[model samples]
Target: MLDHAVQSLREHGVRMTPQRQAILEYLVTEHSHPTADDIYKALSGRFPNMSVATVYNNLRVFKEIGLVQEMNYGDASSRFDFVTSRHYHIICDTCGKVVDFNYPVLDEIEAVASQLTGFKVDRHRLEVYGTCPTCQAEQTHTH
Candidate 1:
């Protein structure tokens, strides 16, 4: 799995540094939609020289190479996902967890894009924000 991720990264003109490989591999394997800091913390113990900024830079590289997807939800931090297939994201406003989802009807939205925006839209991004099951329970109990 990680080998495929690293191979994709190298094909996209990104240097196959250990840090870059580690970050991309983690993103592909982990589904919690982790942020750069989350990754840095988990890795720093193993790699004392790894910097937080390095993690962010690697993520940016991954995004540029189309190896990773980024989601910003006004939470002051960008979330990252490694799945490259066209899909969407769900964010828990309470716990800040993100989940991946696919909508079969999303093609209709793309079909109307050219007519509505008057631009030759080739792709689009969709993200829905709400409470996850765990967060919903916490909210109900807190009330």
Candidate 2:
């Protein structure tokens, strides 16, 4: 996956710097859907000279190249997800965890929407929210 991502970046004329590679590796390996600050903190030790702005810039480049998708769930910070496949997220209301879920695309809804509204339906997102198991356990213990 990392090799394929690097190839795509090179094809798009983006230089493959070590810092950029580290960021890409982090995104590919970690499914936590991290924010820019989270990424900076994770890589700060290895690349002490790398700045938060650098991480943001690299993420922007990746976004433009369609390597990642930025998710904003009414949160102050945007989390980045690697574009592996079409999937939905199940978010933990208590702990803010994002887990991916797969289901058939709702083509019928898009067709109906376009037919009724006279607008081109390009895509859609479905988010399921609930307390994660760990959080549920904690809540039960506390109560």
Candidate 3:
């Protein structure tokens, strides 16, 4: 996946610097859907000179090249997701943990929406929020 992403960037004429590669590698290796600040903190030990701005800029480039998607869940920071395919997110309300789940593309919803509204629907996002297992366990223990 990392190799394919690097190739895609190369085809787009984007130069692959070490910092950019590290950022991309982190995204590819970690499915945590991290924010720019999260990424900066995680990689700072290895990349002492890299700044948060560098991570943000590289993330922007990755998004532009269709290698990643930025998800804003009404949070203070946007989380970056490595593009795979059509999927939805299940978020833990208690801990703000985001997990990906797969379902068939809701083309029927788009069709119905377009028919009812007379507009072309490009895409849709679905998120389910609930307490995660760890959070549930913690709550149970507290109660």
- Which one is best on TM-score? 3
Q: Which tens-of-lDDT digit does each residue in 1-143 have in candidate 1?
A: 67777787667766787777677778877888888899998788878999999999898887887777777888568888886677888888877888889887896897798888888887888879888999888889999
Per-residue alpha-carbon lDDT of candidate 2 for residues 1-143, written as tens digits (9 for 90 to 100) = 89999999999999999999999999999999999999999999999999999999999999999999999999558999999988889999888899987876554778889999999998888889999999999999999
lDDT of each: 0.82, 0.93, 0.92
Residue pairs clashing, model 2:
none
Which stretches in model 1 have alpha-carbon errors above 4 Å?
A: none
Model 3 stretches astray by more than 4 angstroms = none
TM-score of each: 0.88, 0.93, 0.94
Better of 1 and 2 by lDDT: 2
Candidate 2 Cα outliers beyond 4 Å, as residue runs: 105-108
Which ten residues in a row are the worst by lDDT in model 2? 101-110
